[model samples]
Target: MKMIRNVAVGISGGVDSAVTALLLKNKGFNVTGVFMKNWDIRDETGNCTVEKDYEDARWICDKLKIPLIQLDFVKEYWNEVFSDLLEKYQTGYTPNPDILCNKNIKFNKFFDVARNRFQADAIATGHYANTSFGPYLENFKENTNVHLLQAYDSNKDQTFFLNQIPQQTLRRCMFPLGNYLKNHVKTIAKEASLHKIAQKKESMGICFVGKREFQDFISEYIDDKPGEYVDLDSGLSIGKHNGIHKLTIGQRCRIGGCENAYYVFSKDQKTNTIIAVDSGIHPALYTDFLITQDVHWISEEPHELRHSGVLSCDFRFQHRNPLITCNVYKISDNRLFIRLSVPLRAITKGQYAVLYSGEECLGGSIISYPGPSFFALNQQNSIIETRCCDLIALTSGVQM
Candidate 1:
């Protein structure tokens, strides 16, 4: 008799995860439901919905006839994810905590616990992404390995969040909902009589913070420091802001009595100023090049990037705008200089610039700073020096 594979599914008490568990159970595998409690802190109202989620998870596990394993990683999440997130915001850059959560908590911590404790062959999630074991076309010398791919449901594809996940961790993972559309998954849940799970509304906002306002939730951790709002074009003081930490690049600023809505162009942390522009189409809001640090390739660095020094990229998640074609120049072992074919708006610092080749997710890096267009910088005879520990300083009158 053949032995069945024992698979662990990360259940988040949602329809996606519940259906993922059900699918695996019917597929003849020994399935186990694991509920990861990464955040347990309550908001100002003294409410935390984790207990309700736990109950929902328990109900699903009972229906599926599978044992549910509960694991708490609140301390690890606070140290690894939340600390870095706060630091990024403090430095005047908006960071994506969802990507960090996937890399640090879900794929790393939870992955380790499931593999070591449960001795499971593979772990599965409700994420809308697919993985395949195949010989990489770029590196023909290596053996077949796991590679992350976009799901069939383009609208719901989550390869963006999973981009930073290591290839080794991906090898031991399964995405049961990868090939199915969101509606189809709901249809399956309805047919299975999991009506409550099917009708459960999807949670939004930050992963741990639930539906609370972002600024309000963040203010709890960091106190508001008032600052000046200045016009970037005229370099004139316009108004006052409660906190620079509450603002982000490209966000609209509502200066009282100004009919024209001004957008945030940049923030000067040293001077405690928020630079605003009259129009969203301001030249400072767009950039044709950017510098990135800590670049991570999914399998291996593409041969073209190393040799030809160019590749196609998608710098943001679910960006429906035309794809960005850019040239990749290596600044160092851990840094890259990307020159885009066209100017991209709101090229904010601290956001992940994810790269891709067709449908394959090639991973990404944190955008350190937006660089001047090669043409413009060359015309000005500018020289950029990396003097302040990975900080690029332009010498020819170009200021970010």
Candidate 2:
């Protein structure tokens, strides 16, 4: 197929993107390298890493012989992704920043600026996911009707992070590295006489605003206060906690003092209290239904099956959860009901409950709160204890 010549590829000063730009240039396309400065985060000790990132990106662009452009997006990052994350944490729920970052920065901000300012025909990246144009184009606007598919390298497939983008955006985006596995990418980088690029380590872990503990980084924007950690079974106060923002549901470490290992059950923001219980086997951990809001349906409405009475569905990224049947009791512009086939454990609030129908990902939203248990919330305590599983549900009542 003939290729679109003018392209802007996002370079994060990483091997993945470095290879992407080289591949595009190899195909005789006019490629301009763009280094996106999304956050001003430093290393763990609070030193700026921006210069290192810029230098690395510049080095790779020079080797690839492409014009390197820098786009500072710190303001957009705070407004679109990080600010919402802090609000969610303030309410005592875990927020996935990577998911939001992929949506707002890499795709939205990059495409918007690259196309409008640079007059580029297409924006490209090193994402290990596939994209293809749709069959029809009469009704399609620019970059519309695109399809996102799993990358050839399944282990590194990042389709989960790119789900929020609409079909059109995918159409204009390029993934030159989508067809190859990681090892092959390194091999190609080496064969291209870029051995050092091949030897570079991959970037991992949370994208922080500065070099600090996650709690400390978040604490700068959010307040910290003392709270109580109570036993799930006994309802007795076991210890004092620094703040509700410091912990997440289903986490097993750092709380200090418990007979058996305890997992976070619930956090009460109003009272400033945490409840945890022994990570015991309980059918209650497995829930049959989940409540959700802000539903973004990916395909045609789910067709309900008659044979199976249970309507369980996955509530995590990339079908990470088991295949469970779920019934959609109700759905509106923003709210909905999901009845699961079996009880599953640790249904967290504030996290997405992305439903699936076989290979296709149906759209989902933050679990605002868990539905009432078929049985009591807990057997050990007179009052119900919140577990990590209830994260999605409790996040519903959390104020935005």
Candidate 3:
């Protein structure tokens, strides 16, 4: 029934959160600024940007005349987010830390703190997505009917990064910046005399881990043993590598002494070998379907992507959210048989396979590929030789 009055807006010392706090304050909600100290403790070689971020958040809060609170979540960040990431990588799957951080920390931990600790009515953030809590809340004491909608600015939309969060958590969350474009937010910040935030560079990469080489950052937690780089087709050694963990699928750079253009398509931990394939001017790097595990459906009961025998999906986060039919039969209790309507290239593992229908994000899971991997089938390769689509369908089924 009634709209939320007291709100705790998570301020990250960035333009987006700054603008969100300003917008909420203007709307007459009792707003308090909180800077989440998720990764306060860093490794010996690593550093936490907490001091700088806290200072910036404090500065903005003073200017806006809102009470600022710093909540330290170092243990929770290590246990829930980073520890899970290390486990995923150890098992050879790529995991998006930001997604987990938002789900477990922002919506879950941060909301719990605001409700139980600070006694705030609701929690808000700078995420570029709108929220919808249905009118039938009187029937349910705890809200369980929230829907996440796309932001007005498609370019800055962060919905894909948030598909893993539970539906109920989406209820108590507010995204004030969702209705405005980045430029409009900048203008608002400037008019509000928050010009210091206007000139700040946008933060990139994982929030907990700063902008360093991924392998280098992870080495602190996980140790690696070096392996060999081999030609995928030939199985002949081309060069020695520091470790398989140092590389990833579809990577083309930093492997020593390749004759021509070569790309890493897969890695074999059993043989300690990195499979390198020939990637010409334009490599055939596409695929159809993905064997996925660890599914998280926000709204409805989880089901296989197939409804009428085809798996409908969105394989990547940015640009061209392709709508394709799919068929997902169960392979095990967890893993599923993902067969797409058409071929997709570079369907990377450890990447999110977010399924959608029109504007609704149904669910998402991790991407998986079979062994002895090669270039993904495409039209160009079909004219030269065997169609990738056919080869992929035939060979992938055999591997499965």
The CA lDDT at 323 in model 3 is 53
- Where is model 1 more than 4 Å wrong at Cα? 1-4, 134-143, 312-322, 373-400
Point to the candidate with the largest lDDT.
Answer: 1
Tens digit of per-residue lDDT, candidate 2, span 3-106: 45688999888788888988888877898999988778666666666777788899999888889999999999989998889888888777778778877888
Better of 1 and 2 by lDDT: 1
lDDT of 2 at 199: 86
List model 1 lDDT by residue over 248-354, tens digit each: 88899868977688989888999889989898887677778889999998888888777777665655523344456677788887798888778888888888888
| Clash total of candidate 3 | 13
**What is each predicted model's overall lDDT from 0 to 1?**
0.81, 0.71, 0.73
User: The CA-based lDDT of model 1 is what?
Assistant: 0.81
Q: Residues 1-400, candidate 3: write the lDDT tens digits.
A: 6556888999999999998999888888899999999877654565668888899999999999999999988899889988898887776666788888988998899989998888887788898877554211212235556556677888887888888887766766778887789999999999999999988899888765676777787787778777787775576888877666666666774666676767767767787777777773334355555687787777863443334433444445333464566656656555666766666555667877776655556657776653222344433455656556567768788532
Shift in Å, residue 231, candidate 2: 1.0
Q: After superposition, how far is residue 233 of candidate 1 from its true place, in Å?
A: 1.6
Query: Where does candidate 3 stray beyond 4 Å?
Result: 41-47, 134-144, 280-284, 302-336, 369-400
Candidate order by TM-score, decreasing, is 1, 3, 2
**Which ten contiguous residues of candidate 3 have the minimum total lDDT?**
133-142
